[model samples]
Target: MTLTAAQTVAALATIAGSDNVVGDPAKMGAWLYEPRKRFHQSAAAVVTPPTVEAVQAVLRWANENGTGIIAQGGNTGLVGAQVPLSGNEVILSLARLDRIRSIDTAAGVMTAEAGVILENAHKAAEAEGSMFPLWLASQGSARIGGVLSSNAGGVNVLAYGNARELTMGVEAVLADGRLYRGLNALKKDNTGYDLKDLLVGAEGTLGIITAASLKIYPLPEDYETALVNIASPEAALELFQLMRQRAGARLNAFELIPWIGLDIQMRHGMLDRDPTASASPWYALIELSRMAGTAPGALQSSLEAAFDAALISDATIAESLADRTRMWAFREQMSECQSREGASIKHDVSVPIAAVPALIGQGVTAAETLVPGIRPVPFGHMGDGNIHFNFSMPVGADPKAFMAEFDEAVHAVIYDVVLKLGGSVSAEHGIGQLKVDLLRQVKDPVALDMMRAIKTALDPKGILNPGKMLRSVP
Candidate 1:
C-alpha cells in the first residue's frame, strides 16, 4: 500500500534529520514555486540531504516504501521538471550539498556539487584563470544538477556546445540508492556505455545527480560584441555563415532578435537605451572572443565584408564594457520582455542551421493564420538554429481568454512547422510535465519503446521523478 503524506514526511525526516526535512506547506514555498508559475502542486516534504551518503539513504528508504521522489536543484527551470507532479512526492533539494570540490586548471576540469549555483561555478573557474562556458539567463540561481539534468544550452553554445558536451563525468544516486561514481578528468574513456551522458539529460527520471566534473577552458582576453541590423532571417543566416568562415572557433555567439522584441522592451522600459544601430525589422547580436595574442579587428573586418555583400544594413559595435553589457542585456531579456505585451505562447524549438530562416518564416505564417492578430516574436541562438518562437496575443485581448482559446491550437501549428523542417519540438529546454503528452504524440514509436525500456531497467519502482520526461508505465 502507498504511504500517507505524514508517513512519507516522517520517513524522509528519519533518513535526513528533522532539521533537513520540511513538511509544512507554508515553509515549502521556495521548493514548490517554479520559474514559469505553471506547476504549483505542493510536495509532501522537502528534504535537504547534507551529504552524498544522506542522499543515498533517502533514496533507499523511498525506493523500499514505493514513495515518489522528485530531485530539484535551484528551482529555476522553465519547465515543471523540478517541481512536484503528484503533490505526494518528496522533493530532494540538493541545496545543502553546495561545494566546489576541486578546480584543476591544468587538467581543464572543475568538480562542482549539484547545489553549486552556475554563476558561482563561473566565478570559481575565472578565479583559476579558466572558464565554464555554459551561460544561461538563470545562471544566478540555476544549479549544476538541474542544468546538467536538463542538458541546458545557452548563448555560448555556438563556440563551446551544450551542458552535455561540457560535462566530463557525473556522480549520482540510482533509483535503488546505489552510488555511481563516474567522475573523471580524463579526455577519453571508451570503457563501455556512456553512463554520464545518460544521467546528464535524464531529467532525474533515471537518477539523482550529486556532483559533476565539468570541462573548463582558458579565459579569452576580451570579446568583440556588436548588434547589427539585418533585413530578414535569410540575410542574418548569410551573415552568420560569413562570421563562421572568418572567426571559426572564436565566434562565441550569434543570436537573432526580431523588431517586436525591441519594441516591447523599449515600451516597457526594460532597457535604459537602444542597443541597436538603428530601427530595423530584425537584428543579429554577434560576438567574437579575442585571445591574448590574437588581434581585435577580425570582427570589424568581417562586418566590412558583410556590408559589401549587403548581408547587413547597419551595425553598432561595442567599444567599451558598458556597451557590451548593454548589448547582452538586450539579448538576455528577450523572454522576460514578452510579458509586457500580455499573454504569449512560447516554443523553444530548433532546426538545422540552414533551415532557421525557413522555420521562422513558415512558423510565423502559421501562427498568424491561426490567430489573426497574433504578433510573432521569433528569436534566439541563430547559429545553432534554436529559435524561441513566441506569439503575443492580439491587442487589448484578455490574457486568460487568449490563452484558453489558442494555447493548444497554436502549439499544434508551430510544432507542425518544426517537424516538417526536420526540427525538434524542444531545443534547449527538456521535456518535463509541460511536454509529456506532446512527446508521446510526436516522438517515434520505436524510439519511445526504447526509452521506456531503459527507464524501466534503471528505475523499476517508478519512484525517481515519476511522470516526468517519460510517462509512468501503467
Candidate 2:
C-alpha cells in the first residue's frame, strides 16, 4: 500500500532522525528551487541521510511502502532531475554525506562522497598536487553526486572528457536497499557488464550514488590563453583542426562565441573591459596547457600559422593571469548574458564537428523564419560540436507571449535539424521531467524499450526517481 504524506515523513524521520526530516514546505525551499526555476513541485518530505547506511534504510522502507524517492545533490541542475515531479514523492537529499574519503595522487585517483562539492573536490586534489579536471560554471555549488549522475560535460571536455570518462568507479545503493561496493581505482578491468558506466549517467533512475573513485591528473604548469577573431563558425572550425594538429593533447580549450555575447555583456556592465582584440563578427577562445618542461610560445607559433593561412583575422594572447581569467569569464557568461535581453529559447544540441557550420547556418535561418528578427546567439565547445543553440526574442517583444507561442514550436524546428544531421537533441543535459515527451518522440523505439526494461528490472517497485528518464512502466 502507498504511504500517506504523514506516514512517509514519520518513517523517514524514524530511519534518519527527526532533525533530518523536513516536513514543512516552507523549510524545503532550498531543495525545491532548481537552477532554471522551470520546475515547481512540492515534495512530500525532504530527508537528509547522514550516512550511507541511513540512505540504505530509507530506500528499504521506501521500496516496501511503495514511496517515490528522488535522489538530490546540490540542487544545481538545469534540468529537473534532482527536483520533484509528483507531489507525493520524497526527496532524498545527500547533503550531509560530504566527505573526502581518500586521495591517492600517486595512483591518480580520489575517492569522494556524493555530497562533496565540486569545488571542494578540486581543492582536495590540488592539495595533493593533482587536479580533478571536471570544471563547470556551477562548480561552486554542484556536488559530485549530481555531476556524476548527469555525467556533466564542461569546457575542459575537449582535453579531458566528460564526467563518465573521468570517473573510474562508483559505489551506489541499489533500489532494494542493497549496497553495491564497486568502488576501485582500477585503470583497466575486463569486468562483466560495466555497472559503473550504468550508474554514472543514470541520473539516479537506477541507484543512489554514495561515493566515487574519480580519475585525477597532474597539474599543468601554465595555460596559454587567447581570444581570436574569426569571420564565422566555418573559420572557427578550421582553426580548431589546426590547433589540434599542432598542439595535440595540449590544446585544452577551443570555445566559440558570437560578437553578440560581448555586446550583451558590455551593455549590462558584466565585464570590466572588452577582452577581445578590436571588433569582429565572431571570437574563438583558445587555450593550450604547458607542462613543466614544455616551452612557451606554442600558442603564438600556432597563431602565426593560422594567420599565414588566413584562418583568423586578428587575435589577442593573454599577457597575464588576469587576462586569461577575463577571457574565460566571457565564455562562461554566455548563458547568463541572454536573460538581460529577454525570454530566450535554448537547446544544448550536438552534431559532427565537420557539420557544425551547417547546423548553425540552417538552425539560424529556421529560427529567423519562425520568429522574425529573432537574435541568434549560438556558441560553445566548437571542438566537440556541442553548441548551446539559443535565440533571444525580438526587440520589444513580450517575453511571456514569445515563450508561450514559440517554445514548443521552436524546439521542434531545432530538433528536426539536429536529427537530420545525426545529432543529439539533449547533448549534455539528460532527460528529466522537462524533456520526457521529447524523448518519447525522438528516441528510437528499440532504445526506449531497452531503457524501460532496464528501469523495470532494476527498480521493480519504481521507487527510485520515478517518472524520470524513462516513463513509468505502467
Candidate 3:
C-alpha cells in the first residue's frame, strides 16, 4: 500500500492545489533550510494549506494513505522540529493560514492563528495597549504554532512564564482528522484530562496546532536597565537574590555573560563601542519593568544595596534609551558572537537555582579535561537557572574533526553533571530529531511509557510528526 514519491505529491496537490504543493527540491529551500542545518533530508513534498478546512482535509487524506506528516512553521527551529526526518514524510506548513481571530484587552486574551508571526502577535497586543511577553531573538520569523509546540522559553521568563504558561488554550487537528477546539479566555478551568497541556509541548507529535488563546499583560511604562559587574557566578547569584527581593515580579531579566563575550564582540567589531563599565571578569544584565504610575530608580536602589552587601563590585545604570539598547544588544547577541571565535559545542540545560554555580563549575572542568584548552562561555537566564553552557574549540582545532570526535563524549560528561543536579537536559528547546536517542537513555522509564501510550492513543497510525521526540527506531 506504499505510494511512490510522485504519487504522494500528486495526491497532495489534488487536496491542496498544484501551486500549493512543492515537489521540486530547488524551490523548497525555505522549507528545507533549518536554523542549524542539522536535518537535511528531503521531504516527499511541502504542502501549504490555505484554510482550516483544507488543513483538516489534507490530514484526513494523509492518515488514510499512511503518509508521515510533519507540521512546520516559520522553519526557524533550532532542533530541526520543522524539517523532515524520513525522506518519505510530507511537510505541512501553516504559513497561508495567518489570521488573528480576535483580541480582547479587557479579558487580557488574544486568539491568533498558528501561522501568525511572533513579532506580528506582539504588535497586535501592543495595538490593544497590552503586551505578549514571549520575546525571542527569532521572533521576527518564528510563528506562534512553533513557539507553542516547542513550549519556548525566552529572556523575559523571569517575569512572565514560558509559552505553556502564556497560552490558555489551543485548537488543533488530531491524528484522525478531528478538530479539538479548546480555545477559551478563562483563567481557571478544571476539566477532565488536560489535553491542551498535552499538545502544547508535544513538538507536533500528537496533533497540529492551528490557533491558540494566549494571555496578555498590561504594557509597562518603562524598564529600569543596568549592567552590574560581578567577580564570579557565585556573586552573580547573590546579586540575583537581592534583586528578586527588591523587584519581585517586576524583575524582568537577569542574564549572566562572561568576559569572553565582550572580547569576541570587540574583536569582530560587532559593537560600535563597549557597553559595559571598563572591563570585568563577569557581568549580569538586569532590567526591572516599571508600571504606569511607578517611578524609576528601583533598579538603581537595588544595585546600591548589592554594593553595600558586597554582592556586586561595580555597576552601570542605563541613563538613556540608547544606553539601554546597547546593554540589551550586548546580552542578546551572546549566541551569535560565539561564531566569530570558531566552532563551539552548545547545551541548553537548567538546574535548581542554588545548584547553578555547581553545574557551571563541574561542566567547565569536565569539558576542559576532555578537550584541553576548550574555552567555556557559560551564560544566559541566571535567575531562571537555565544556562547556555557552550565551549569554543581550542585556538587551532579543525571544526569538523573536533565535533566528530568530542560531540558524543562531551555530551555524556556534561549531561551526567546536569542529571546529578536534578536538571533537564533539554530546557527551552524541544527534542526534535536531535535528542531522540538521548531521551531514551536519560528520561525516566515511567515517563517514557506514558508518553508512548499517549502518542499511540492520539496518533494510532503514527502519521503526525512521526519519529519526533520519541525513540521509535530503537
Candidate 4:
C-alpha cells in the first residue's frame, strides 16, 4: 500500500479525470465483483481511461508511486484474474477504450482496441464479409484484451484455434508505461524474441494489452450441423477421428454432451425440444462449415459412414436455421442449466485429445467414489479435450454443506486424474487468484521459475496485477 486510499483516488482523478475515477466503494461493486461470485475484495478506486494515452499516463503514475493496478475488461471472466487480490490495488477498467481501429478483409485481419467487446468485433468482421473465430459464451460482454489475456479457447479451437493463435500482434503497456507498438498483420516475422506471444497470455502479469490485430476468416456460405447419439466417450473419440479424417479443417465444432446435461436442460425447459434423433446415453453436437460454391450434406454423409460402421447409434442433422440455432443453444447452455439442479463442483481441465476417454472415465469414477450418489455432468470441447468436468450435489444434500465439504476434495480427485492423463489443471481459464496455490503445487519447478523471472523482469515493482498468476517472485 504505497499510497493512502484517499491519496490514491485523488492521484488517479488527476491522471484520468475525476469523472473517470470511481472512489466510492458503493460504486466499485461493478468493477470489484466477478461473475462467479467467489472473489469478494474491495479496490482502492476504479478508473476507466477513455483513451490509450490516458491509460499510459495512469500506468506511469502507478509505477512511479509503487501502487498496484489490476487491468480489467468486461469482468465476465470465470477466473478472478480481473478483480483485486488485495484491497490496496486500483482497478484499471479498459471499458472506455472500445473501438475498431481498422479492418482489411482481403488481408484477413481486424485491429480492435482492448475495450472493444468481442461480439462487436464479430459484427465488425462480418460487416466486411469476414469472421473472427474465437467464440465464447461471454462474447457478448468479454473484451478483446481480456480474451487474449486469458488465451481463451472455445468450441471453434478444433478449426480456427484459440485466442493466441487467432492473434497476429498486440499493442500493450509495459509495467513502466512504455508503449509496445507490436500491432501488425504479418503472418511471419521471425526476427527476434516474439514479444507479442509473451504478453498475450501473461494474464496482466507481464503487461497490459491495449489492442490487438486479430485474424479473420472469410464468411462461410453455410454450415452443416447435427446431433448424434453415442454410447460413451470412447465411442465419441472414435467418431471424432472419423470426422477429422472426413472433413479436416472444415469440421468447425464437435461437442460432447452427456445424458445428464440433456435431462437437466429439459427438466428446466432450457430448450424447446430435444435436439437429438432419439434418447441415447450421450450426444455429440457436430458442425462443419460450407464455403462458397461448396456442397452441403458433408455432415450427413459422414454420419452415414459412422452409422454404417456402427460408430453412432442414431443422429439428426439440422434441416433449418431454427434447428441449428436450437442445437447450439442446447450446447451453450450446459453451464447455466446446472443451477436448476443444485450446487455443482466444477473444473476447467484439459488432457491430450487422445486421452479424453481415459480422463472422463477415471475422473467420473474418482468423483463418485469421493461422494456417493454424486451426479457427474462432464461436458465440453471434446475435440480439444478440455472438459468442463462438474458434479451436482446429491439429490437431498444441503447445498451449502455439500459445497463446503466437497469443493476442494472434488478438485483434488479430478485434478489427480487429469494430471495422470497429462492434463492441465487450468485449461481455458487463466491461473487467476483462485488457482495460484494449485499452480505452485502442480507446475514444473523450472517452468515456474521462468515465469517468475519474466514477471520480475517486466514488472519489477510488482505493480501490475500483484499476487496474480505468479503469487511471489521468490
In model 2, where do residues sit more than 4 Å from their true spots? none
Q: Give candidate 3 misplaced runs (Cα > 4 Å).
A: none
Model 1 scores a C-alpha lDDT of 0.94
Runs of candidate 4 exceeding 4 Å displacement: none
Candidate 3 residue-wise lDDT, 146-210, digit = tens: 99999999999999989999999999998778999999998878878778899999999999999
lDDT score, candidate 1, position 215: 97
Error of 4 at 310 (Å): 0.7
Q: After best superposition, candidate 2 residue 81: deviation in angstroms?
A: 0.8
Please write out the lDDT profile of model 4 over residues 1-474, one tens digit for every residue: 468889999998998999999999998988888987999899999999998888999999999999899999899888899999878899999999899999999899999999999999999999999999988988999999999999999989999999999999999998899999999999989999999989988888888999999999999999999999999999999999999999999999999999999999999989999888899999999999999999888898999999998999999989999999999999999999988887989999999999999998999899999999999999999999999999999998999999999999999999999999999998899898999999999999999999888888989999999999898866
lDDT of each: 0.94, 0.93, 0.91, 0.92
Residues 102-218 of candidate 2 have per-residue lDDT tens digits of 999899999999999999999999899898999999999999999999999999999999999999999999999999999999988986988999999899999999999999999
Poorest 10 consecutive residues of model 4 by lDDT?
A: 1-10
Q: How close is candidate 3 to the true structure, as a TM-score?
A: 0.98
Candidate 1, residues 77-98: lDDT per residue as tens digits?
Answer: 8879999998889999998889
Task: List TM-score per model, in order.
Answer: 0.99, 0.99, 0.98, 0.99
Clashing pairs in 4: none
Question: What is the Cα-based TM-score of model 2?
Answer: 0.99
